[model samples]
Target: MPKVSKWLRRWSLQLRWMFRYFLQWRLRHISDRQLVIGVSVLLGLGVGLVASFLLFTTRWISSLLAETPFGWLSSLYFIFPIIGILLVRTYVRFWFQGKFQKGMAYVLYGISKRQGNFEGYHRYAHVLTSAVTVGLGGSAGLEAPTVLTGASWGGFFARLFRLDSAYRVILAACGAAAGIAAVFGTPIGGVVFALEVLMANVHANFIVPLLISATASTLISRMLVEHELLTPREGLPAFDYVHLPFLVLLGILCGLIAAYFMWMSKQMTQWELREKKNGNRLFWEELFLLGALILFLPPLYGEGFEWLDAMINHHEMAYLQRSWWGHWLPAEWGIALLMFLVLMLKPLATWLTISSGGNGGAFAPTLFLGGTTGYLMAYVANHVLHFPVELPATMFTLIGMAATMAAYFHAPLTAIFMIAELSGGYHYFVPLMLITAIAYATKVIIQPVSAIQAAAQKIGAYLPADKDKAILNNISIKHVLERDCVPVPYEGSLRDLVDAIARSRRNIFPVVDKDGYLKGIILLDDVRSIIFKPALYDKVAIAELVHAPPAVVDIHESMEEVMEKFDATGAWNLPVVDEGRYRGFLSKSNILSVYRKRLRWQIEHFG
Candidate 1:
């Protein structure tokens, strides 16, 4: 029996290797464009199916834990959460080599800096950690973790197939889009999110891949989940000109709250480092503090999705229902008080979950805040102020989702499209546009840069997803370098330099030694007088007038970097060096021509 088992295992390994070799053979033979799109669709389906499994598993575990024999202990709500957090940190610290990378910011960094390469371990790392974090009643959700998984899939396929860095980046983005599409069942919104938040742009070449991936993933996710998480609206809002003023007010208020969330997130993110520097063990403190804190704020525990559902349905939510002081609190702590607490505490709890090493995304938190804010604001107006006109609170909740998301990420299209897909139609397009615009404008007016951009700037590695710049970053300096510059020897006389200069068509001259080592550059302007003087032409050695001009461009430098040198030195051209040898020269004009041609190709072909 033992010999038979070993034989079976050996055959399995051989079969797997044979299959992988077959894939590699095809990857090497097929056209890249067709192969990429085909693989991307398959990857999208894989991400969506995996996301659905995670969704089911987490929800099942969460429900089982909350409704089991010892369910009453969850009223205390702090014990299992402590166990959950401890287990998560312990696993990450010991098992995963102390690496914890799961969030939107991390994904953005991978796209902009690392060209979408990610470890296979991280795909499961984020899923497992987020499952335990949010499923075991941690104050977060799974959208961001799912994104990491999707991106990992994209990276895995690209790397396995040996795709170029640019293709890897695009597919990684497609993975992210597929994840969002499947997770939210919002394909258009997912595409926009990939463009607006992940890739940070909608390039012409990217639309086809993103659409294919998102659509495929959404189909798979919809099949697995069986229903939409955010069902579209059946009817339009009762919104008219009368609601405009209040809608504007809601937008401004949501912007302020968005700013507050960003500030709190930044502060909480740094709190651990600050505590460690002060000789405090923040890990244990974070666990204990979160445990103690959630015990008092029951609404802030878990993903808070159920609580949002109750609010949307206008059901009596449980704030002080299971509170430590449940007996003493008044019964009047109903929907209004619950609404107020959610608005106030959701942001803080989200920051706690994210900063304290719990894995999740801010999407759910931002949406919750927006919904509660709009719902509560309308509730107050109708009940407290006795406004002559009353509007539907649900409309406010839906539009507020977009407004807050836009303000938080400064991605208007993503927020708007996401809400539109959620609502099932564009019946409320006017209000959606107005609310998104006002919220985004207010946030931008107060803070010129968005939260993620601000964080990137702090790290001194800001990566803007501009099309022209992205292309320039990939292009090599050698491709456009001017090798036609005639070299002049450092020891040559003015007459000898003049003879060489006459053979060249440019103003700049590279001064090299007898052994072909670059000494410096001598501009024609600097030696214009000495070259024209008949008496001094032979008397002057070019070595005496060796003036180091602007910066030198390396053969390995990217065109993006070469342009920075041009801007810094205010020079039209610079010398290029290869291992201290004078390789060639690079002019700003020559580089721009190449850039324009590439840009045109990208637009025409990609679009």
Candidate 2:
């Protein structure tokens, strides 16, 4: 063992030395921009390979625990999920300070506020926990974890090279793009997903680097990933114009389903119930309940991609019907009913595990919901309405998956492109777009925000493009309000008031009583005429010069409300009242300065 350890360390040092020389040589010949793209390509390749490994490992774990030799234990495979959850909860509570982050929302938050600078633990936390969660039968996907891993790696690479904040954000985005591209094996879709869902800003310069990274990652993962998520099946249905109208209906149904899922997720946010009565001691109680649900509905286990494959491929469907669990069912109708029931329960199962703190993502669930919804819709039209060969459920299944993804994500372009690449052509482009647009429109009418956006909002962050709003929302009035304004005592004479104004640079001053309670404001503009009249200046008291402010800003109020106050009052500044006491003054200028700084940073890093 000692000899092996020594040999491994010596070999690692030699490889590092060689890689350093190679990078140095490459940097010397390339421009800074070219070098960045080159680094992005390599990063994409690495991310793709890692994503493929994660996909295969999780798939292998699922089969090893649930199939053949363990078929007798099929009833207990659900227990494996419990063990996985407990392990994850334990690791997070003890080793990771109890912060079991589960998705790419945190990465988006980081990009918005910290220029993509984030903690190191995030890179491995998702990989380990998500692998365990999906591997052991938790109803989630590896996409989110892979995205986080790639993003963290990109951040680390930027840090290693001491790259500027702007470069760091771009690189982090590149890594994320590569991960998605590799995982789904859809380069264009991956690039658009990164830009639309993760990046704070989209620009012309970003396109080339993202393209380079996404293409490289997809190619690399194609070589490493097994017959899993990224591997497109052969003999997928060709597009038939006769199915276009049905595709539209499928898209609308997807939108409605997305809305229902979002609403259900909100209802399942039962942290308030968990925190009732006492402290958050022995937290993870919900995991056990979620475990029981998976036990009853075996189809909820993992990402449900296997079911999706079966829905589109008849051979796979027939094979599923012949499995140990399937043999108990009556016949064709029995297996079909089981499939339908699984589809119906999938959303609820995902809600239970994920909302309860399981480490995973909704990428797979949304796809599953869409595919099943599409397939079921096709089944109804063909079997019930007797539509002959005019429609195939498999064709609608493909469109349905894209529609659901587009609606839930509110990313029609990404969905369309991803579906196109996944199915290996633009054959269904017309219907894909038609369905994606209708679904997105329906989603907008139902819920204005996507699940991803809503999740990030809990941390006071919004989607990447709304950086200014996110910053304003996260910072409180106490942090940015001007606290250095001069104050005049109500009892003070004009002489005293003038002395206070002369010494202070501010144009607005607050009038306070002896008890430090706010009375009114005295603006330099309002007092200018009085100050010039020598007779009134020395004779008048501060109280006579006082003018009531149009409005008062509360420290606890949101920046949006505060800005509205500024607009309604038409005042340059307003007094900040906290608990009915004058704390400071808030001005439009001060808020604008902070906003400009944040906006400038966002543009530099993401634009």
Candidate 3:
């Protein structure tokens, strides 16, 4: 009876072992390229579908709310200005509670820290509040919410997969790219934008997956929704050789415009800070005042979306052609003057939205504001200056979009690519590049860090100067390698070799001669072959069965270099030796575990 019980137990153990063997075999063959491609495809599909649905949903809600009998609820647009104020206040109030202070800042933090984890509930709250604020007519765009949603999803998935810090950051960037692509229907723009804005560094290793995901998302979004949020300009003439001087002038004007916006945004935040300190006003109360201001400003009251629609359709309004409210005021200077004013105010609107706690993205608003400014400027140059340059207002608008975005976000390449994607060609590359260069240089001269970087610094989170090299070198094989030594004699039988290898936490074992000198390594395959041919198993020594010249690494070498060596040799496990003696072994699982843990720590603490 006891023998029968032992036999049953042995059979169960054998079954478990075989199951594990099959699982490992399956995992061993799964290539990293295949995993990256598969993940990219899935992410792209999800981002595309979600972005398109959201775009349509936002549009439908805005239209329905405007047309309803309660369409006076459209007066709710007045509330957006205040809502924007409230959004900024909420972010500021909660700034010290975590490492990430704002949505964009959080994304950047995740990338720099290599841990993208954010408080899901808190992030959801921010999104809901912002959405309500913007939907009711907050003078903000929807891109911010979209980006936050995508970033949160990426962070969640990275954690779930137990990805390393580098991969986690890359995935988060991919998420942002996917969201942008889906929302704008510009895959190339999204890809470049992610690299420029979210990732501090760009490497070839990350480009493939990022681009693939962005393209997939864009395609998916197109299938779901047919409308383009920001349509391309129509009826624009190609650049002429005579337009070179005018283009340079336009670039200079864009730089100045970008600088003005940056200044206004900074001032608005400073004003809010002062008001909060002196008046002791709560966020909601300040929001009410902001709403009242909007209600009083006749042009701003019900005209926000109207103006946006006009800009989109290339229709210039008489009022916009004549006036400047604060800096360029009075309504008589014509289209050129209005353009300058709008250019100056674009940053103000963006700042207001962020400050008021309005839920929306600066991306779309920046484009809208920049385009309007450019149109006005171009109109002035042609009609007022009589430069004989027929440069379209749309072209100026596009340039303004790129310039303003480049200045504030510090992503010139992204700005250029995004404009090209939106405009549908590289026809304006020279002008766009020139404008981007000017804007970037101007911003750098005035402010060394971008708003996103500023927000990160406020929360005590900043990218290390040599972070990549430090992380790679810091991960040493000595820190993660398995030290449990279970050596097999060269003269040992095949059965003995199999048992010894099985007892260890690996499939490979080092074989030693009688004098403790290292012979070679015997892998599971060699054991299996010997087992299949019973004659060999019975007659051959372990030395005969072992594979010669085992791949080995020193105990003190960096795990990164060890990994590279393993990759080059296609070895899953390598023996760790010190001087002339074999210490133990290292496997991919050990390195992977260390990386996963490091990433988790960064996310939980920094994100």
Candidate 4:
């Protein structure tokens, strides 16, 4: 064993030396921009391979239930999901150290708060957890786990190369793009998703690496995976201008449904936050509820992509046979009613799956809901409503997917490109754009925050729309605090204050007691008149001159709140107090100076 350990250490050192030599040679030949492009391509290819493996493994496990060695066990398939959830819960409790995180909200938190730094285990944990959960029919999507795996690898690469924070974030985003691109074979969609959902600002220089990474990942996935989410099939319908009015109505309807999804998601989040229900009790309750839901809505099992495909391809009856209601209801009504149930229950199912200790994300569920809503709308309009012009159900299905995605994520471009690539062409681009825009607009009108933003807010991670707030949120109050201000004794006369001023170069002075509690502040301007008159300075009391500040800043206040205080007080500086003790002074100039430096750093790195 000692010999093997020695041999392994020797080989590791040799590999590190070789990598260092290669890096030196590459640095001499490659520009910084070229290096980023090269790394992006490699990162994308790596992410694509991992994503493809996850997809293949998930599909294999999903089909495992049907191929059970004993036929009788198939009747107990629902119990398997409970096992999956328990497995995930066990992993989270032991392996993750009780810090189980899932979904794009966590990714946003990492980007906005952690400087894109993710733990090394994240590269593989999500892949394993999500595969087991979704594969065993936990009713969640695999896309989120895939993206997190990709982003973790991206952060890993950035650390390996010792890249700066800006590059670290960009690489993380590149990984996310590669994961999405690999899943659907849509490089453009992946690129837009990274820009619209992950990144706060866009630059021409940033686009090159993103595009290269997405394309490389797509190529790798195409080589490895046999099927994509949107593989074009025969008899696929195109967009029809005659269905414009129906498309408009579908957009509004999708928007309302998306609002419901967001609301339910928020409610579930609140429920999960209840202190008493967060442990084993909550897990078992959610598990039982999820089991009941999947029993009746069999289509809710796993990611529901198969069901979505069945709907879009006009194979509703064949797929509906799996449902209990399929035999009793008429063909058209069965499809519509089943779709309606899936549409409404999808959000609840997703909540149950995630809240019950399963590992997955909302990406697939949102698409599923959109598809269901679109299919039901077109089916009912044509069969039951008897419209003069037949609505294209397939086209509506595709558009519905995009519209709901746009509203849920607040990303119209990503949605438009996602469906466009899935269709294998730009045939439905016009309708995609039209419907996504209306849906996003309508949803924003009803619910100001996107689903992702709402989740982010719960964790105290602010994702601001404007550039200024984005930078400010990243800058903590401690980073900008000025501790150089000289403190004046609360009981000291003006004589001591004058002498302290001579020792210090500051204009503002804080009146602090012997125990370090702040009493008030004395501005240098207010004491200027008595400084020249020594007799008057000795006679004047510091307590008489000290005045209460317009406002005091807490040490833990957010930068936005600090800025608001400065604005409200019309003061250039404010005293920082924590628990009635004086800490330091916070000046507008210092914050602006730090803000400028950060802005420059962003411009340099991003450009």
Candidate 5:
């Protein structure tokens, strides 16, 4: 009967092991590239639907606010300036309080640190704040927050499914692409944006999933919005060959303007960092200040989100023509000056609005600034040089958009594709590429880091120089282990072993023979098991308590192999042996501690 019982136990163990092996095999199969692509597409579709709905809802609400009986709600323009102040206060306070906030910085951190495992709360806060700020006519856009939401969702899903780090990063990129595709209804732009800006790498491996997800998301968004995506006007007046020189000259000027925007963004972020260090205010206070600033900006307050809608639909010129300033101002001189001033001020305003805790993105502001710059430059070129370019202003506007974005973000491809998508594939590829390249080159010469990179560095989370190095190769048990010898003889008592473990701060001990050869391993569990059985504790040799055939490792083995062995054996410590003699025991606690310290150091120094 006892033999039969033993046989049953062995069979049960075998069945359990087989079941686990099958489960692991299934999981491995699911992590293949095909499955990842499918999942990304599905996620993109869902994101697109959500983004389109949000865009429509925000526009509807803005319209309703304008039409209210207190039509004076339109005059709430004065409130935006105050809101801007509050936004700054929020950023400052939160920064000082040590709460890791979400933004592009966090996205970068996730890619580098936790394998895109972002905290959900951080993302949620951004969404809530951005929505409220924009809803209240804060001079900002919702694109950043929307993208963050999608990325966070992707991160959460990847973690939940136990996907590898590489896949998680890819999924996060996919989610961001989906958000952009949905918002702009430009799948190509979305894909390129992920590669050029977020990943900063355009390898074939990333492009495949990015394109698939972006296309899917854009399709879904179109279905939800039930509106044709924006496209540039067709059959516009063409530039004469005589105007080519003027366009090239205009590109150079746009590059300079882009450099200014990038500089202003940096200064604003630096000021925020300085203020946080001084402890003058908190993040919520910045939110209040941002609210006040929103109240003061007339252009931001009167039309509100309607302006963005107009810009997207190419009806912005109509609104401008109807404005009070447009009616009184000289078409050439006054409007040109106003545009130049606004172009110079827009980046600063965006910085103030965002720093003060206003919920918004940089995308809308960049577009507005680019259009304004382009208009001003075109007017000057035509009036001063009598340039024969037809619709030179529109050409400059598109170029400005790409140039400014490329300069600020240091992402030329993303800037180019984004403009292309927004323009509905307008045939300005030659000019756009030229302007984007020049702007990128100019910015690179002027500033080594971008706004996102600078912000990330300030917040203690920066990307490593060599990110492609496998994490396994970088971390090793041998590197972390202490090179001291401590062991227990086979005859040692449980109490003795316990005392030694406490003093050594180790959970496992190597039981060695008199000749200093490793006999077996005695874990904390072994001590606990015999703790109440005092008679056995004293009488039983450590050998009797030890698990035989200690999991052993050579000093030169890779950490990856060590970890794999540790996992397979389910052991917290493994003995290090030279030949047949026990050298030391490597504890999991030590390995983990080293890894944590390294991570903390990376965050503090590099970030």
Candidate 6:
């Protein structure tokens, strides 16, 4: 065993040395921008293949279950989910130490708290877990897991190549763009999502690499996988100008529904957390609830993309095929009733799937609800209310999908372009723009932050959307601390102080006692009068010259608090102390300098 360990250490050292040599050679030959673009392309291709595999695997398993042997066992619908969730639970317990942090929330937390660093298991854990969960009708989407897998790879490569934090985060965002583009076949939408949701601030430099990555991923995914999940069928009608007013009304409704979506999801999460005790009792309860929901609501099965596709292509009876009471109601209003029920209950199924140890994302669920909302509105208005002209249920379904996505994610552009791209063109581009804008605006007024931001805040690692707070939050006080300020003994004479001043470059001097406790500060301006009279330098004590600073800065204070202190005291520099002992001084100028450097780095890091 010792010999094997020694051999492994030797090989690791040799590999690191070779990597460093290659990095040096590459640095001499290529610019940072060129290297980043090349890496982005590679990352896109790799993430594209992985995303395709996840999609393909989940769909294949789902298809196999929907066929003869498995399909015949409709009475035992819960069997697949039982096996899938059990496998995921076992996998997570042993492999991840029961710390299976999946989805967009985990990714956002990584960006905010870990400098875009992800655990090694993140690259494959979500893919393996989510495939089983969604494949066996666990009632969630694969997009979030795919995004996390892409982000993990991005962080992995950045660390492998020894890139800075700024570059690492940007590369991670690029990976996310690649994942989305590959999954949905929407390159531009993927780029917009990365910019709007993942990255707190969008710099000019992020555009090119994000575009390149998304394009590459889309191309690779197209070559490998010739399927799409949420795209509407062809031969759809063009947008009519007369439906603008109804579209606005639909937007308002979707905004309200978006709020409900977020609220219900939060309630479910809190309930699960509160009841996470009693020796697997809560798990069984959730499993039972999930089975009941899927048994009645067929659209809640798997990612629900197939059901969404059925709605898009006008397959109304698909919602009632396997349900107990679905056949009891009339065909006309039965579809509307089921659509409404599915819209209301989908969030619960998603919560159950995830809380019961299934791995998947809410991206698909949001779209499912949105499509349901749109179809319901158009169906009721045209058929029940007997509108003069037939309102296009197909177009409304597409619009609702975009509106709810915009509201929930706070990404209007992503929703607009994503729906347009999925529908195969920008034929309804103007309607998409108008409704998404309204929905986004309404949701923002109701809830200040998006669901992702709220999740990040819950973990105490939220990066604010405000540019100033975001920049200031990243600047640590330790990094900006000036430790070069000279200290003078409390009993020392002015002559000694003058001598100390001559040796030190800083004008502020911290006075300390025999026990190393902070006495006070001695500013150069306060002693300028006595310094010229050299005869009194020996007579006057250092304690006489020292006085309390306008404000004292604690070493542990945040940069924001330090700035507030600087402003309130109106002092150029303040003494920093810890537990009444003198440490150093903090200068307003130094803090500003560091802040500027960080802000500049955020904007122009590639250069």
Judging by lDDT against the true structure, name the best candidate: 6
Q: In model 3, how large is the Cα lDDT of residue 513?
A: 71
What is the number of residue pairs that collide in model 6?
0
How well does candidate 5 match the true structure, expressed as C-alpha RMSD?
12.7
Worst 10 residues of 4 by lDDT: 68-77
State candidate 1's TM-score.
0.79
Give the Å error, residue 486, model 5: 3.9
lDDT against the true structure, per candidate, is 0.77, 0.77, 0.64, 0.83, 0.65, 0.83
Q: List candidate 2 segments past 4 Å from native.
A: 1-39, 49-53, 66-71, 155-167, 199-201, 227-234, 270-285, 315-329, 380-386, 466-499, 509-565, 574-607
Give candidate 1's total backbone clashes: 0
Q: For candidate 2, lDDT tens digit of each residue in 327-442?
A: 67655555567657766677777876665557888888888888878887777666555776557767777788899989998888888898777766477788888888999999
Candidate 6 lDDT, 231-269, residue by residue in tens:
656667778888899899999988888999899988887
Report the C-alpha lDDT of model 5 over 1-607, residue by residue, as the tens digit.
Answer: 9999999999999998996785588676754455677778777877786687667765655555554422336334445446534553465467546353656666666665566777776445555556556655666667777777777767866665566666787788888888778877778878877776677533466577788878888888888774343344453345455656666666566667767877787776778789889986756555454444343333444213344344333454444453435556555565455455556666666766666555567766766666566656766767655655544566666677777777777777877887777664457777777777877677777777876777676755555334332244356555666655458887777766766666776566778888988888776776776666657657766766888744688776666577778889987767887777887767777776766665564444223
Per-model TM-score, in order, reads 0.79, 0.78, 0.65, 0.88, 0.68, 0.83
| Candidate 3 regions with alpha-carbon error over 4 angstroms | 1-26, 31-33, 68-76, 80-101, 122-130, 282-309, 318-341, 385-387, 463-607
Candidate 3 lDDT = 0.64
Each candidate: RMSD to true structure?
5.4, 5.8, 15.3, 3.5, 12.7, 4.7
lDDT at position 456, candidate 3: 68
- lDDT per residue, candidate 1, 20-136, as tens digits? 897778767886666788888888889988888878777877877775332357544776676777778788889877776767766776776567888778677877888888887
User: Per TM-score, what order, best first?
Assistant: 4, 6, 1, 2, 5, 3
Tens digits of lDDT, candidate 4, 205-238: 8888899889999999889976556544665686
